[model samples]
Target: MHSVVIIGAGGVGSVVAHKCCQLPELFDDIVLASRTESKCKRIAEQLDKPVRTAQVDADSASQLVSLLQREQPELVINAALPYHDLNIMDACLKAGVHYLDTANYEPRETACFEYHWQWDYHQRFVDAGLTALLGSGFDPGATNVFTAYIAKHYFDEIQQLDIIDVNGGNHGYPFATNFNPEINIREVSAKCRHWENGEFVTTPPLSMRAHYTCPEDVGTYPIYRMYHEELESLSKHFPSLQRAQFWMSFSDAYLQHLEVLSNVGMTGIEPIDYQGQSIVPIQFLAQLLPDPAALGPHTQGKTCIGCLVRGVKDGKKRLIHIYNICDHQACFREVQSQAISYATGVPAMIGAKLVLEGQWRQPGVWNVEQHDPDPFMADMNRYGLPWKVTELDPEFQLDTEEHQATNAVH
Candidate 1:
């Protein structure tokens, strides 16, 4: 049994803590911390078993270092804002604790989303004999694992990859993000880029579109192509990948609201003087929007996320779709969170457990696909996020003209 420290107290954090409690033998002691101790305390209160709670400013490396030293945890699971990744990583190095996070580090001041920043720590972690796992969340986490599992067992060479993320959940709100509004808006507004022919090709954000009928009664939803951080790692790890892209579904109402917000500068991350105080427009907007955690009671529907791969196997062209469908109501009933948080948080717990149990420990910064996917996949089944794979003989392809027409201005 190993002690673990979890940072952040959002919907995802809550799920991670509950899932960790499920495996009491593996996680002997658990400490949950965030800047707001009350938030952490609230989550801890809901757990069936006892979990220690503390307040630590994740932005301050020294504070985190002190917490880590006091707790002496075997591993630290970071579920905080993406901006605090480096600070937490630095603190981990100081405390000599293994680190894992669900998302890549993205600075608050920049809209750029890439892995170069965190990947730079490879040498430091390797030299320190510490492990740092990046992108353990659903898409980057589960999607990466799915690709690796396919490459290992089924494919000779993966040539093309498309990751589709469809969240069909409804929170009964006209316009509200499922996660942090600031991060969500920034990611959607940024230009889309994908790897092709050994380099990244860029396009307008929400430019390329396609329609997909999600399996398991998910119905048809229009998905728009967007550049995601996972594409960077997958292309590097899977050298045979000639082209890779990421797509997500957005409703017409949501897009219209986003366009209006963009026009009015409400989505702007830049600081503005409002009533004698400087405030980031996006951050202020986030304050007004319903918190993702609070949406649990009202959120209903399902989420379908998966990887569609086309490659060569046994000298023959092949295609496969490996995906998972999660119910929002089911997740709420279990952890007081929607499926989005449950999906992301469950993998995070499993990833950290794998490390603490010594099943996935390694001395270097790594992505989910860098390790064996079998164990992680098995854990997912035991946990909440079970997955399924279906072979596609004809391959999942969208008509170019139809796809373009969908995205065309009405």
Candidate 2:
């Protein structure tokens, strides 16, 4: 029987637990831990399988290590905030357990997220004979695998790559983040960076926009290029990628509200003195926003997330699109989460299952792309997230002057 401890009791954490329980043959035991034990218990009640709940501050490495030691699970699935990634990884090492996380580690003081901090721990994890899997969530997780699977089967060498994520879901909130508000605001508000000419080019946040029409009537959305952690690792792992960009759909109303928040300094990450007490504006603002986990019941519509690759195949130019579409209501019915959390959490569970099954269990810190994507891709189909691949005309492209002109008119 394989035992795993899942940290964090948010929407993604809940999804991971529910999916893991669905496969008792693979996961015989699960312990969901969080800062507040009640939150963990709440998630436990939603599960069909019995799950043990524990309390531990993810900010404290010592506390996490203590919990890991007590539980002594084979692996720790970190569905906690990105800020807690490193602490939980450290605990995994101390407790001599494998580690898997959905996102890369970022210092809470900064809005940026990078793989260097966790990648630096590669040798340590290797020396300990433990595998540290990074970016197992949707964008970084399944998207990375999709890129590799396509590259392996469809491309001789992929030169240009674009990852488009569109969430057409509506939760009826004028202003609410699909994930953690602090992380979402910080990421979306950060300066954009894209890889080109073997170097990363910097641009203003959401400065570059394109109109993307998703297949199967998922609806058309305005996608803006932004810096996501996957770009850093994907570029490193796939050297043939000359240009790589990450694009996400955002509503005008959402952007307008974010702009107003930014203008008022409400999105700032730095702490400011308020009534002689220090408080971070974004943190306070997050508290005011609707909880992403609780938005599952109200959210409707779907999300289309995938990679568009232009490369070489058999001495001819080729363009291939691989993607997955997830409906918010369907996910809510199964895991009690919207597509945003469902997209990320499903991949997290798949990655952890692969690790436990020894299909991706290799010692050292590694990104999802570094492994053989075949098994992971197969699991994605067998699991809740089924995908589709379509070969488009070689001339199909995302960013062009035509797209710009169309956006300016609207």
Candidate 3:
């Protein structure tokens, strides 16, 4: 039996706790923590079994260290925001606990979504003999695993890659992000970078658009090219990759609202004086938006996320797509969270499971792709996120075009 402390009691955190409880044989003890202890308690109530809840300021490394020392779990599953990733990792290092997170580290001041900040901890983790698994969520998580799995099973060497994410869900809201609004807005508004011909090419955010038709009648939507953290690690690990890009679906109303907010400076990260107190506009705006956790009750639709890889297999050119489809309502019925949280949360549990089982417990900071794909892929099927692979023509391409509307290349 393994004990785990899952920080941040959001939708994803709730999903993780419930899923962990489902398999009591592996995760016998579980603790959920957040800045708001009430939130942790609320998620704990949803689980069928008992789960400990605690309050900790995720922003403070010392507070996390104290919590980790007290709980002394075998692993720390960070369902917290990207901003808290480094702090949690630091706390893990101090407490001699393993670490895993769904997202890469990003400073609160800037939306710099790079892996170097977390990857720099590789040596320290190795020296401490503690494992730190990065990007265990869907895009960076399952998507990274998908790329590696396809490369291992179907390709001799991968050259070109296009990770297409299409979410056909409707929440009946004008402008609400599936995850944290601040992180979502910051990511889309930042400069876009895509790996091409051995180097990253920078372009304006959402400057490149394409039309994608998802398989199995999941519907057709417009996908926008954006910079995702997985591209950084995949390129480094797979040097043969000549071109790699990430694309996500965005809806018209969401884009319109985001543009209006950006035009009015409502999405600004810098704090501005508001009636004698300084407040970050984006953070304040996040308050007015619908909580993503609540969206589960009203959200209904399907999500399709896949990676299309073009490469050489046995000296012959090949193209294949490995993807997973998730239903929002199905997820809500099981975990009381939307598909966005479900898709991300399931992978996190699997990653942590692998770590506890010693399959991926190597002492070092590593991305999901750095581990064996077979175990992770098998668990996806055993758990909820079953995947399918479709062999495409060697000439399949992501045609660039103008598009509008949809969300979740998460």
Report the error of model 1 at residue 155, Å: 0.7
Summarize candidate 2's per-residue lDDT along 1-410 as a digit string, tens digits: 79999999988999999999999888999999999999999999989999999999999989999999999999999999999988998899899999999998989987779999998999999999999999999998999999999999998899989999999999999999999998888888888899998989987778888899999999999888889988999899899999999999999889888877887888888899999999998899999999999999999999999999999998999999999999999999988889999899989999999999899999999999999999999999998999999999999777532222111100
Per-residue CA lDDT of model 3 for 1-410, tens digit only, reads 99999998888898999899999999999999999999988888788999999999998988999999999999999999999999899999999999999999999887788999999999999999999999999988999999999999998999998998888999998889999888988888887899998899987778789889999999989899989999999999999999999999998787888888887888888899989999999999999999998999999999999999999988999999899999999999999999999999999999999999999999999999999999999999999999999998887677787444222211
- Report the error of model 2 at residue 403, Å: 11
Model 1 clash pairs? none
TM-score of each: 0.97, 0.97, 0.98
Best by lDDT: 3
Q: Please list the Cα RMSD from the true structure of every candidate, rounded to 1 decimal place.
A: 2.3, 2.8, 2.3
Deviation in Å, model 2, residue 209 alpha carbon:
0.6
lDDT of 1 by residue, 216-264 (tens): 8898998988889999999999999999999999998988888887878
Query: Which runs in model 3 stand beyond 4 Å of their true positions?
Result: 402-410
Candidate 1 residue runs with Cα over 4 Å from true position:
400-410
Q: Give the range of the ten consecutive residues with the poorest summed lDDT in model 3.
A: 401-410
